[model samples]
Each structure stands twice: as structure tokens, then as C-alpha cells.
Target chain A: MEPGYDLPAMIGMTEADVQTPALILDLDALEANIARMAAEARAMGVALRPHAKMHKSADIALMQIAAGAVGVCCQKVSEAEALVRAGVGDVLISNELRDGVKLARLARLAGRAQVAVCVDDAGGVAELAAAVAEAGTGVRVLVEVDVGAARCGVAPGAAAVPLAQAILAAPGLTFGGLQAYHGGAQHLRTEAERAGAIADVVGKVRQTLAALEAAGIAVPCVTGAGTGSFRHEGASGVYTEMQCGSYAFMDADYGRNLDAGGAWTSPFRNAMFMLAGVMSKTRPGHAVCDAGLKVMSMESGLPVSAREGVEYVGASDEHGTLADPGDVLRPGDRLRLIPGHCDPTVNLHDWYVGIRGGVVECLWPVTARGKHF
Target chain B: MEPGYDLPAMIGMTEADVQTPALILDLDALEANIARMAAEARAMGVALRPHAKMHKSADIALMQIAAGAVGVCCQKVSEAEALVRAGVGDVLISNELRDGVKLARLARLAGRAQVAVCVDDAGGVAELAAAVAEAGTGVRVLVEVDVGAARCGVAPGAAAVPLAQAILAAPGLTFGGLQAYHGGAQHLRTEAERAGAIADVVGKVRQTLAALEAAGIAVPCVTGAGTGSFRHEGASGVYTEMQCGSYAFMDADYGRNLDAGGAWTSPFRNAMFMLAGVMSKTRPGHAVCDAGLKVMSMESGLPVSAREGVEYVGASDEHGTLADPGDVLRPGDRLRLIPGHCDPTVNLHDWYVGIRGGVVECLWPVTARGKHF
Candidate 1:
């Protein structure tokens, strides 16, 4: 019933001409981040399975695959479906699913591509096996060991053995490995802190591996890591696959992470930005931009302005109040905003206006933008 | 390219069978909220203009209009376009637009609907008028006065007079009244605090009105109020139109606002919920649900669990950690989550599964979702 809402910008339009509240991707920066991550994973002797949950764009996922990523990791069945349908061959759902409908979808998706899912419970394994048997497809299953995230998965060591055994015995399912990602360790602020957190995570993963080895089951892969702690996990010897997502589109939160020397110098650069327009500038020392909670998420923190002398102070539903000390911002002026968090903020937009050399290069649809099933 | 991503649930399906991470709208509670808000507005002697930005659903906006709302308010040009194309005849963009492309779109949308927009600057008025003239349509224009909201709008008093006069002089534009919204006053916690905040807003609005009157300008309407402080603004007599959006879908943040007796006795009930499944329950005293920052915005705060003895403690990208001291929640179990904020949370979903008597009655498309021009 709805029409006439055009895309934010034309491909050849200048960055200044693009509409406000549009998600902009620096093409050069994104490519550099992808290449760097792929090289780093190769150098560290770990398979790179960049998380697709961050960008949720099939085009970006295909790019990572072309750059030598083994596959991509998604957190939801719907996301995997979106990517696989868009020609992605291998996808690993790095999280667990308990719903039968979702498991059925996952099994059906396995008929099309190489699909692997994580499980931490017997009920989940049973449901998944039923779906896969009904679909007549063999789906890879991984035992999710808690490892330090404490958010999901079975306990560290022996508790995962039964889950792995269940997967091995279930019809139309194969035990892939262990899903041991520690999500909490990704953003520990300091290099020492993140390294320490991953060290603990590696210990838990090793214990789980030893238990599985005792059970005479060979683990194919141990997938986990994030932008903050990927270096530690990549060198941990226990992790065989890295699922770093936000390294592709570094945000203000990741930019705040301290390096080994306690400096903010990181190999990755900010690639994603929210281009906002100054909608109202009537008040002195303050201006309102067209990007706020609706266009950018603020759970981690407020967006950081890319321009000097302007600070994004507060965000309402549709308006971001900027602290313009010099009152230089005027009506219709555009500003680039680095979101606090990449994944959730990227989820808020439909199209990523890819730009390079101050001009829009492409408009990639966030293929799985709202695929939250 | 995605062919397998089906709707979360079909019509007539049971609520328990609906997919996790789906946005559920309790139909009974939603209708009651709409009717009550309409009745309250009638009793308060003010026109109801429910903000469509909250739900972004054309179906919900139509229901509000059927219940006696004069029109609906939006915050973006594309949102107005979406609703207008979906048969919403009258739309008022409650916020300012500075980009020429968006203004042009807004002007064209006015050709198909009764469209009005707010402006706080001379340049905005000029650009809007030009677009309206180019489109050969007359558009209503409102002078937004900063009424205690430091985010946007011109200064409170005599500053509005020149802007209103400018609107009157511009071609294809008719000066409507003032757009004085105190967004920060909406969530003042206690009734006394909210009442005090709105009192200040009313005073500023009155000053602006007096200035406009002294300048021999007549204001046809004054629209701006929200769910939290609507009662105060409704009784102010200066605000002729109330723009309360969250009353139809109360959130955890609004649920925390206290009444006049310093108790949590709100007239509105929460009709909206995020139905998530317990994906992992391996750890004692803790469980992880399949809803997180992707499905729900946590800027205001984390979502409050609808079940007793289960508390939502933390959120990651795709998992919500619940503190289940009793360990009653198990894998595949469902929990209804009341999001901290309603507007942005609703934007994260594609469809609203409307339930009544524990069955899916309707699937409403969030028509204007992500239409952030």
C-alpha cells in the first residue's frame, strides 16, 4: 500500500547531496578493514568467519567471502536464509536456537547451503534433528560451551560432551565442533583486560576440548572472537576460527579500545557513519541533527561527530542535539556521525550509501535488515 | 532474493506458536488504549493528533483516526509519505526538515494528503515554501517555538513572531499555529516533576502566543504533548491539540512514571511486547533469550521481564541474559518483554503480530518503518 519513498541517494550523487539520517559506508575503509582482518586471520592460522550480523548485507558478506573468508557467521536463521539465498554458500549461525519453527527453517536452509548451528541443550538437538530428518538434509551442529560469555551455551568442560554426543547420535546431523565465543570479552576497554578475558576463555575452551577428546570425538573447529579480543583468540591455539564482526565497520565504542601501548591507535578505521543534516539551529551553542535514536542506536553511547568543534550531546527519538560551541553549524549542513555501536546502529537503516572520494559509489540494501526471527 | 523468510506467524495461529523475536501487539489492550486516549482528549477539550512515528504502522494510524483523532503526527518526510500513500489522509510532520530533497518530497506528498510541517528558521520556511510552490500545492506551516525542549525550535517568546510572519508571507504556505513540544518533560518520573516541567513549557508557549498576538497574527492550533505529560498539557488550555503516541503501546520507561499519588498507577496499559524464546538454560540462576540490542533498543534501560521471578539483567547483540533465581525458565519457553522504549523498538520489527485471547488475530505491517529521509 506504500510507495514513493525513494532510496536515500543516487549512486553518483555527492556525499553532500545525500539525504540526512542515511547510513554511509566508506568504501576504501571497509575494503581495507576486510583485507586486514582476512590477512590477520591467515597469519594467526585461524579460519576467518566474519560475522554477518553486524552489517546484515549480502553484498558485504559476498565481499568478505571473495576476500578469502572461509564463510560468514550469522546469529539468526533468517539472516542465514537471506545471505544463502543471495548466493552465499557457507553460513554458521553462531548462536543457539530452541524454537522448532526456526530449526525447521534452518534445516530447510541446509538443503540449499552448508549450514551449521550451535546448540547447548538436548531439547534443541532433538528438535534440530527432527527438522533436519524431515528435510532430508545433513546439518552441521556445534556444541556451545559457555567459555566466559555466560550468556548462552552449556558449561565449560564435561557438560558439553552430552550435547556433542546428542548431536552425533541425532539423525541427519553431524557434530561440527565447539562454539566458544566470549561476547563479554570483546569490549573490555584495555588490551590487557581483553587479553586477560580471552585467556580465561581459552582455558575454558581447552577444558571443553579435553573433555571432548576424552569422549573420543574430534572437534573440527572452535569458532569465537570479536573485534576487541580477536588478536588474543586468534593466537590462543585453542581457537581455530575467528568470528569478528565489528572490525569491518569500526565504531566509536571500538575506537575507544586501548591498544598494547595504552593508545587509541588501532589497525582498523571507522568505516560506517550516519550522515545527518542540521535541521534546526535556532538556539545558541546548540544545533539539532536529523539523526537520533530512530536512525542510530545509543545503548553503548551517543554517536561521536566526525567534525571538529561539534559534539553530539543528546539524542531524542528523531533529533540529536549537538554541542556547537562556535555556532558554526547552520541549517542544512551535513555532518558524519560515528555510531556508538556498529551492529545495532547498522540494523536501523535500510540502505548503506557506499561512498568514496566524496561521492556515492553504491547503494547496498541491508538484505537482512529486520530478519530477527 | 530472500524467498524462505516467512512471516513470524500466520493468522489464527496460537500466540505460543508464534516465532520468537516477534513484535506482539495485544489487540484488546491496543484498542482500549486508542479509545481511552480519544475519550480523554474529548473530555479535555483538545483535538487528538496521535504521533504515527511510534508504531509506524498504517493500520494503527487508521485505527487512531477511526477513534476520532483529527490526524497523525510524524517526524520525517518519508514517514509522512508512507502513511499518506497508505490512505492516511492527514499528516503533520512534527519536526523540522532542512534538506531540500526532503522538503521537495514533503511538498509533493502534500498534493496527495493534508500535509503540514513545522519550521523554526527563516531558511527552512523559504525552502519549504519554494518546494510547495514548485509542487503547486498549499501546505500548512507551524512555527516551532522552543518550549523548554533544548533540542530544536526557535526561542520561546518574540522569536516565534517573525518566523510566523515569514510563513504567512511565503507563497503556497499558510501559517498554522505553534509546535511547542517539551520532549524532556514527558519522563520526569513523578507527577509533580512532570507537572512542574509542563508548567514551564506552558508558560513559554503562552509567551510565544502573546508575542504572536501582539504582532496581529492568529494561531489556528497549538499542537504538542506526549503520553507522560499529556494531562498537564491538556489542562493548560494553551495547547489545542495533543500529540500523544506512546499511550497506545506503553513501555517500561513510561511504566516507571509515577502518578499524582506517587504510585505507579498509569491509566494506560502496555499493549506491545517482544516475544522471545529461552534459547539457552544450561547455567543455573541464568538463562539467555533470543532477543537483544538487535530486536530491542536499550537506550532508556533494559527491558523488564513480564514473568514473575525472572529479571532481565544484561543484553548483548543477539542474546538477553535473564537472572532466573528459581531456574523456572527452560529452553523453548516464551517470555514477553516490555521494551524500555517503544518507538525505536517497534522500528526493529517488520510486522506486529496482533494477538487477542492468546491467538494471532492480525498481522499489521509496520508500513513506515525505517523511512528516515
Candidate 2:
């Protein structure tokens, strides 16, 4: 299968002239976000490993690496393969690798690049070690401690010891560190809630590290944190690397998070937008845009209109009904939508059209897109 | 961008040997669905124009066409382009075409196949007329009527006549009647609600046709309906064509609709399944699968596990938490998920692996996948 869109049609066109349902990236805002996160990480004396799973593009990953990122963190083996294929180094699979086919690919990638993966099961450790030995490659293994996400990873403290020891016992695997991503805390809304969540995560990390030390298991690094609570993790002295993904494309959901003063406190501006065209205005109350659930991620929530006053009301499979009260939009009129979640929304499109001053400056192929397996 | 998984890694592999996070299609179930729909349409004496937007695969479209379909209805011009490019002829853009680039491409496609598109505006009619004339091809026009969906289309009765007249006035265009799809009626829990919704749709369609006939416009065809309400529209005397998609890949949401007897009455069995592998079972209550929102469509609802007693609980970006109470499933166990909505779920993957007797039989590329423009 080939991606239908090879190159962008918005090269010489203005932002208004660009095609509908295109992923538009504001380079200025993106650069500002990259710089902001890098500066924050540097000040906190922690290495930044921006989550490549959020963007799924090596171009953005390279940009972050160029701006002082230690590496990129992916959730899938195929994602790691795609990023490494694009010449990125020091890639980490932040999630578990159990499928033999994927583990074999990860082993192959580990031979070429500095590859690391998280493991929560001691039983699966031997399986991964076999694949690593088959490929004649060394893979760094991280013992993932369940830090309140309740999704993946072992329980904190003593529960991580067996997994770390299993990795240490394996010939082709090195017991690297721990992955303590408090995923549920990322979007806790209030700064206190987010701070409290991270505080709990910090306590768990300390507990786990102390338990591992009691068992005479030396841990090198501890990686965890998303864009929503990266500040707390960066400030924590125990966290060595912060894995913030959506810092570059601060979406509507993250934009809704409040600070200590109860105001939206995202340091990043909206760098990502899904461009849609008003396809119909015949209806009295609402106008339909060409983009909807197929292109935009509605997991967090529906997209918000970039223009003020116009509200995104409803959506079908292929159309978004905008509540156009003043009839400001009509057929052929273009609009930008701030997606609720940037990662899944980015997964829907093939190219990210970078727009600056209403002109298309860069187009990056979502190289790892649709690499679900 | 080139697709990462260019071909099936499960050609000779058994169901157990197939890779994780793959789309597995039951060929027997799919064939049964196609035959059932075709039989239903034939018995009702209405032409079947299965909506290509659901599958977006030319291969499946060809199978649909081969199984006694008149043609296929696509929600986008780019989907039609990809389908027609793959040799499936007689394509209809079921949605409105207003964008110039898309319209021009649609016109160019009209020169190759029996092409038609929907239009609800007079201004867009003139624009499409220019493109159709430039391409020197006959493009049929369906004046979509707002038959209670409230999303797109001009109002029924007197409102749609002018648009139908506009299409007739344009050169290289033929008035292809009305597209009155009650998309909202498809998921009404009870059969009476669906029947009532279609009755209302039929009334509006009749009113619009009466207005068109009063203006001396002869209607050639009326296309509408989907997997849920196709029986209602097909039985309606006014509807000439049924645009039923998702029949071949019955999803969980569609499976929820009750029949006249208040039973799960879809003649189509669950043909489409999203295959996910158990990556972690370290947690006592729930196990995490490799597939989540990134691969599956959770908009309608969470996926139902195919195995008895196994329930889908929660999801993250890369992990789906499955509540495996009986411990029947563990790490490396493959589970089939009945997707919430098949269309968007199909949009996430690249290939569809056909399984028969628990053996890999057919592998079809989701050729038009991600043709969102």
C-alpha cells in the first residue's frame, strides 16, 4: 500500500488557498515550543527525549534532536524502525515488545542504532533476549513500574525487581533503568492535581529504586512524563529524562489545562491545526466542513474552530457541522481547527504542511504513519 | 510516503502465526454479507450502490461490484479517484463536490468512467460545470436533499428544485436525481424508529421530487440508505438505489440495532475484526493488548471481545486494557475485536488479511486508505 498524498499541494499557495483537511504546522510556534521545552529540560538538568509517537515523523524528531534532545521515545517497534530508518539515533520503545515479529525487528534496529525497550514481564524477558541474540545485537531494557496509569508496567517498588533482574540475567540485554510514565496524570486539568499526581509518581520511583538497590540492582536512568506534566517531572530530582511528546503541537485538550492561578498555562502556542473547507452552508444553523472523525482525533474531544465565535457543533463520518451563527463561512471558505488530541490527529494525515506568513515552507511525510503492526 | 508494511507477512502463516495488531477479515462471513445484501436488494428490486467510503479499498469495491452492485458511492472525490484508478467503474461522489482541485480531478475521472457527483448549491454547480466542460465528460449530478440529517444538502420540497434545475442547465451534466440519506437513522436501536425515520425521509424525498417534477424536471434515479436502514429505503417505493456500505464488515455499533422482532436482526454476521495481541498480563485484573485508539475506532464505543467472557475495559495510546476474568487469555494470545465502527477502524490500517478455516487466504491492500482529501 502506498500513501496517496506524496507531496503537498500547498507549496506555492497561501494558507487560505491550501487544500482542506490538511495538517498545517506553524513553524514559528513549533520552534518556540521546541526551544521552550529544551530550555526547561536544560535548566532542570535532565535530558529531553521528546515522544516521537506523538508526531510519528522523523523530521520533527530530528529537529528536536538538533535542539538538544538526547533521543526520541516511541511506543511501537515499527515506529522505532521508521525513525531509525530516517537516520535518528538513540531511540527507545517506551512500551512493551512481546510480538516475536516486532521484537525481531527491534533487535535488528538495536544492531544499527542505540535501541532500548521497556519490559514489565520477566517471562517475556527471555523471549526478547532470544530475539536479541538471534540478531547479534545488544538491547537496553527498562523495567516499567506501574505508576498509577494501571495500563502497562509492573507494580512499583519490589514488583520491578524480578523484571530488572531478568533483564540483567539475559546475555543480549542490559538492565538500563526504569520507565515510570504516569500517563493518567498528564491531563489532570488543575496544576495542583497534575503536581500531586507527579508527586505520587516521584514517590513511586523512589520506592522502586530503593527496592532495586536493596536487591543490589543498579539503575542508571528513569524516564517518564508527557507534555501535560513534564514540568513536574523535570523539576523532580529523581527523574533523569523527561518524555514529553505533545509539547510541539499544543492541542485543544492540553490548552485547557489550568495553572496555579487557574488560567490556561501552556507555554506552547497552538502549532498544529487541521485545515477544513466549508463545503455546505445551505443549512440554516450550521455549516458543514469537509473534515471530521476520519481526519481529526475525537478521543479527547471534538475540534475547536480556530476562528473565534464559530463553534464545532457535531460531526459525521466525513463532515463537521460548525455552528455558524453569523454566516461568516460559506462554500469554498477555509477554516482551521484545533484538534483535541494532536498525536492521533497527526496519525490521520500523510504530510504536515508547515505554513509561515500564509505560505507553505515545509512538508514532512508522516513516515511512521499507519505502521500499526 | 511509502507504506512500512508493503506486503502481508502472514501469507503462509496460520491464524496463530499472523502478526499482531492486524485487520483480519473472515472471508466466509464477508462473502455471506455480500450475498445477503445482494439478495436483499434483488428481492426489493432496488439497485445496490455500496458506499466505498466504508472500506475505501478498490479490491473490496470490485468484490461488491462483482456481487451484483450497480456501482459504488464514495463520500470523497479522492476516494472515487483511487477506486476508479484501480479499475472499478461507475463511481458516484455521494457527498457534495465544491473544492476546485477536487472537482477538477472528479471531472478528469468522469472522462474515464461513468462518474456522478452530488451538488446542493447553484454556485458550485457553475464551477463544476466549468470543470466538466473543460474535461469534456458527462458527469451526473445528484441534488442532495436535507432529509432530516441536518448536516449537508439543500432543503427538500421547493428548495432542491432550483439546484436540480441548475444542474440540468449546465453543459456536460445530467440531473441524476436526489441523494436523501438518513445517516442518523442507521443506528436507531429499534426497528420502528428506523422505519419511522425512513418514512420521514421518504416523505421529504417525495416532496422534493414533486417540486422538481412541478418545474418539468424528470428524475432518473434516487440513491440513499446505508447498512442499518437499507431495508427501509429499499422497501420504500420512492427509493431507486440503496447506498449500503458496512454490510460486508458489520461492526459492533451496527450489531446493536434491533430488528422488527426486537432481535439482533442484521442478516450480516461479524465479518470484520481488528486483531490485537496480549502484550502484557502482569496486572491481576486486566491485560494490556497492543491495539488501542491508534488502530481501532472507539468513537462509537469500545470494541467487544470476540471470545466469551472477555471484556474490553479501557484504552491508552498503545494499550487496550482487557478485563480477562477467567484467565483464558495470556501473553501472546491473539484476540479478535468486533470494532465499534468498521469504517474509521478500517481507515487506521493498511492491509486486510482474509482468514478462512483459521488460515490466511486473501490479502487485500486498503488501497484507498487515508485518501481523506
Candidate 3:
């Protein structure tokens, strides 16, 4: 229904005039955030592979690449395909890929670009190799190492060796080094916690690197670090790359993290916002907004209202309750909500109404949205 | 990207052959659910206006209407617009709508078919009335009452009179009585709790009806109730129309609702499922699937694995952790997850792959998806 609808007709409207329940991107904040991150990565001598899973937009990936990022990282093959089709020549899927269908798509996508993927299981190597052979192209395989987050990936030391060896054994696969991402570190509240988490991960990476070198394999790359701990890992001599994605779009969860001085200051500015309208304010201090869980992600926590004197208390399917002090918000008043989590929250909208100088600069379709497969 | 990609190329394929992270609707379960709800509403003599927010699909609405439903109720104006475009007439937007943009679109929509909306604010009435007058059409405006939700509604009794009177005073607006939905009772867990909650709401509705009648305003309709507590409200005689959604697709939250003997048995079956692929199983007694928060709604709770020996323990952005006891699921094995909540979970996907006899029978686009505006 939206394909036929005039979704892009709001291109020239001002921020205040654009329709509510729209995903608004502050282009100035976005450019500043990107430039700062690129400068930091270049200074630290680490390649920046911003995760596409965060923005899920090919347009954002292009901007990052232009800002000196070494391609992008995706969590799914479909996302990689979208980026590749949109002319992103280099991509590293930070997550593991199995299942014949996805592997074949990844292999096909490799023909369009320099495609790489992470692996933790030996059985997955043969399937990926077979798909690559069918596609008549090769894919770089990074053996994922579990540094902290007890999620996908092999244990950080010698456990990843067998997977690396299997990738080397495959004819159409190139054994790229370790893919170690400590996802839990991205939400560490304090500087000490974020730094300590990355420090331990660096120690494990050292052990993994030594083990791989002893096995007569050259460890080419060690890519891992998120928005919360990327600075820590960027300074580490052992790390080769920082996969910071959320730095491009600061969320409420990341905003909660403390800096070195124990103050709430980050290098990045919050560029992503959900524009909602006040739909009801019948009660004295109570109000309801049009955006809710279907439009905003509430995993980390509820969105912090950008408006003063108003508090977002709760949300249902399509209604969000706001505790407005003395009814500050009436019907038709637009409110900006800083989402707690950017990745999934961005997934909720179809178009990002890019705003610059209070004017709608562009309307980029969230191209890779709903591409879970 | 999906329009070019063959997403439904697996139409005649079995469940194992279907793609990962797809919203699968079991045709058998769906038909049975529709029949059961239609039968129950018939027995109770309540007009069934199943909420389209649960499915957000006009195809499902047409099916409900075919099975003896008085059209459907939508929570958002865009949803109602899509359903009307698809030829499902008589839509009652069960939530309050403000803002000129939405009201104008809604007014335009009312010209296509029978459109009704709820109002809780007098200021909203002026704008809605302006839009209706411009459209040269009239709309049934139901004065929303705060029926224990603590969300978007005026107080039930005389407090609702001013809004009702305003709706009556507005030219091109027809006062359609009270929109009293006890949202809390939907998840009250016990039969007595749900029944008691609705019983209290009934008393409030009676008072509101008296107040409206005394003010010379005729309360034409009183529509409320959901799949969880629809039975209780339908029997309450005060509720003339039932807005029960989720009966077509029962989720884990509804599955947790207890029946007469405190056993987990609702008349409806668990039909809506997120078909996920086991993407990783590197650790013993643990596995990871391809579906997570991006695919299922975690608000009601995390999804439950349909497989007997496996359990979904946690989820991240793009992956869900499964505690597989006994080393059952391997990478590439597909499993269905019963989502915790049906409404927002359905909002996560773009297409619903309808399955019948272990084969993909149809693929319906979630047409109104991401239509929050």
C-alpha cells in the first residue's frame, strides 16, 4: 500500500511540518557523528566497519564508506545483498551464516562485492563452500570467537582453530582472521565497566592470535568492538578493526553510558528520532501519543521524550501514555522521542525523513528493513 | 529488494523448505480460529468487529467479514485506510486520532466507505469536524471513555458528556455513543479477574449511557472488548459490539490465560508462529535461531519454542538463544516460535507465508505494515 502512496511527498517540508510518526534523521548530527568516528578510526590505525544492522540503509553505508570506512558489517545475508546491490563493494557479515538458502545468497552476493562472513561451526564450512562453488565466486570466512557475550562463536583461544582450519580446507573460502564482538560491552553503564570489558576481550584475542600463529596461519585481522567500548579497543595494539555501529545514531541506552570523567558525554550526537503527535489530552496531567511499541523499540527501556515537562510513562500497541506536567502537550503537538535502541527501532519505520536545517533534505527508504532472512 | 527477490518461490515447498524468519500462518489453525470466533459471537449475539491491528492484513479482514463479522476495527487511521482500500467497509478506528494530517486522510477515507473514529478531546472534535465538513461527508464519532486502561480516554460517566456533546454539536459528526475498552482485563490471567473487570466497566457504561440520555444525546452504539476478555464483555449486554482481535492467531500470552479449572486452555488454538531456522549450535545444550526482537514482539514476553525439547531463553537484536536440552536442533533445522503478543509481532514482518499440510499455500503481504502515519 505504501509503494503506491506518496511517502516521499514530504521531501521539502520542514521538520515541524512533516507528518508525525515519521523516522526523522538529523543530517547535521549524522554528518558530525560520522566525521568524528572516521577521524578517530584513522588516528587509531584501525579499519572502521560500521554495522549495517544498525541503520539498515544503503544510503547510510555509502556515506560511511565515503567517510573512510572499510565497507560495512551486516548481521544477515539479505542486508548484505541490499548493500551490495546498492554499490557497497565491501561487506563483512559480523554474524555467522548457515542454512543452504542464505549461504547461496551470500555466495551470489560475493560475486557483486567483496563479501565476508563469520563462522563458528565446522559443518557450516562445507555448505558455504558448496554455495560459493555453485555461484562461481569465493567468500572470505572469519572464524568467530566468543570473547564475552555467550552467544554465537567459538571459545576465544584454541576452540576457533578447527573452524579456521575447516575454512582454509574449503576451496572457495579464504580464512580471514578472528571475528570477536563482545555485544554486552556496548551497554556498560560506566567507563570502568566498558574499558574493563574490552581489556579482558583484548587479553583473549591475544591468546587466540598466538594460537592461530602457532598453527602456522597468518592472523590477518581481528575485528571487534562496539560503540560503548570502541575507543578502548581502538587504542589496543592487538586489535585491527572496530565494528562500531551505534555511534552513528546514539540511542537512549548508549546515552546512559558514562565517559571518563563520569559525565554523560559521548563523541557522537543522537541523530535518530521518532516524531510522534499528541493524540489525546483529556485528563489533567495525562496524555496519549500516536507512537508506541509498533513504532518505537522498548527493549532497553522506554524512549526519553525530547520535549520538556513531558514524560513517556507507558505504551501499548498504538498508543503511548505521556505524563505531561500541567498538560504541556495538547492534541496535534508533535513530540520527538529518542529511542532506547536504534537498530530495532529503525526497523519499525519504512522511510527516514532526513532533516537538515529544519528542512526535509531527503526521504531514504529503509531499504534493508524487514530483511530478516 | 524483496520485490526483485523471489521471497515466495517456495510456495509448494514443505515447512522445512520454507525460508527462515518468516511469519507462518497455519491455514488449518487460522480457519478453525475464525470459525470458532464467529460461532461464539453468534451464540452471544454480539456484533464481531475483530481488530485489524492484530493481523494488519486486509485479506484476513475479508476472511473475518466473510465468516459473519461486521467489518473490522483498526487502531490506526492508516490501517483503516488500507483495509478500506482493499474493500473492507465499515471500519471503526478503536483509538483516538488527532492532528490535521491524519484527520484529513481519515476524512478522505470516510468518503470511500463507512468510517468511524473515537474521540476523547473537544479540540480534536473541531479538527475532525473541519475535515469531515471539507470532505462533504459525515463520520460516526464515539466518545472514548477511560474504562480502566488509564490511557487515552475521558472518565466514563458525566465526564464523557462534554466530548459527546461537542461531537453532537459538530455538523458532519454523528455521536455514536461510548468506546469503552477494558484493555487491562485482556491479560488479567483469571476468569474471575477478567469478568469482574468487565462487570465494573459495565456499571460505568450504564452511568455514561444515562448521562448521555439525560443530555438528549442518543447513544447509538457501545463497542468494546478484545480476544482475551471478549467473552466476558459480550455476555455483559451493555457491550453491543465485540472488538476481539488475536482470536485468529493465539500467541504465548493468550496461551497463558487460564480457563475454568485454571488449566491453560483457551478455545482458540495457537496459530501465528515465527518460523525460524537454527542458525548456530556451537555449544552443548545451547542453540541460536535466526529470529529475535526484529521478528517477534518481546513486550508480552519472549517467544516459546514449539519444539518439545528446546526452549527460547533469550534474544538479542537479530538472534534468539535457545536452550536445547538433549542436543536436538542442528543448524538448518527449522522451528516455529509462538510469539508472546500477536499485535506488535505481526508488525515486525512484511509478509505472512500461509502454510497448509506442511506446504506453503500462499504468501500475503502485510499490506498495512509500517503504516503508523
* TM-score, one value per model: 0.98, 0.98, 0.97
Q: Which candidate is the best by lDDT?
A: 1
Residue by residue across A1-373, what tens digits does model 1's lDDT show?
A: 1123668888788999888889999999999999999999989989999999999999999999999999999999999999998999999999888887788889899989999999888888888989899889989999888887777788888998888889888889999999988787877888888888888999999999999999999999999898888888988898999999998999998888887686543788999999999998886798989999998889889999999999999998888999999999999999999999999998988899999999989999999999888
Candidate 1 — which residues are off by over 4 angstroms?
A1-4, A262-265, B1-4, B262-265
Write model 1 residue lDDT over B35-140, tens digit each, in one string.
9999999999999999999999999999999999999999998889889989999999998988778888888888899999999888888899899988899999
Task: Give the chain B TM-score achieved by candidate 3.
Answer: 0.96
For A139-251, candidate 2 gives per-residue lDDT tens digits of 99998889999888888889988888889889999998999998889899998899999999999999999999999999999999988888789888899999999989989
Interface CA RMSD of each prediction in angstroms: 2.7, 3.2, 2.4
Name the lDDT of candidate 2: 0.87
Query: Number of clashing residue pairs in every model?
Result: 0, 0, 0
Fraction of true contacts reproduced, model 3?
Answer: 0.84
Alpha-carbon error at A236 in model 1, in Å? 1.6
Which of the predicted structures, 2 or 3, would earn the higher DockQ when compared with the native?
Answer: 3
lDDT of 3 by residue, A1-373 (tens): 1223437227677777677788899999999999999999999999999998999999999999999999999998888887788888999998877777788888888888999998888888888889999999999999888898888988878887777888888998999898989999878888888888989999999999888888888888999898888878999998898899998989988888887786544678999998888888877888889889998889889999999888899988888899987777868888899998999999887899999888889999887988887
Between candidates 1 and 2, which one is better according to DockQ?
1
lDDT of 2 by residue, B1-373 (tens): 1123444345656887677788999999989999999999999999999998898888888888898999998888778888888999999898887777877788888988999898888888998999998878889999888899998888889988888878888889999999889888999998888889999999999999899889898999999998888878888899999998988898999879998675554488999998889999886668889989898878899999998989999977778999988877778889999989999988988889999999888789888888887
Candidate 1 overall Cα lDDT vs. reference?
A: 0.90
lDDT by candidate, in order shown: 0.90, 0.87, 0.87
What does candidate 3's lDDT look like per residue over B1-373, in tens digits?
A: 1223537326777888777888999999999999999999999998898989889998999999999998899987888888788889989998877766678888888889899999887787888999999888889999888888899888878888888889888999998888999787888888888888888988989989988888888887899998878877888888889998988998898888886796444588888899999889988899999999998879789998899989999999999999988999899999999999988989988889999998888888887898787
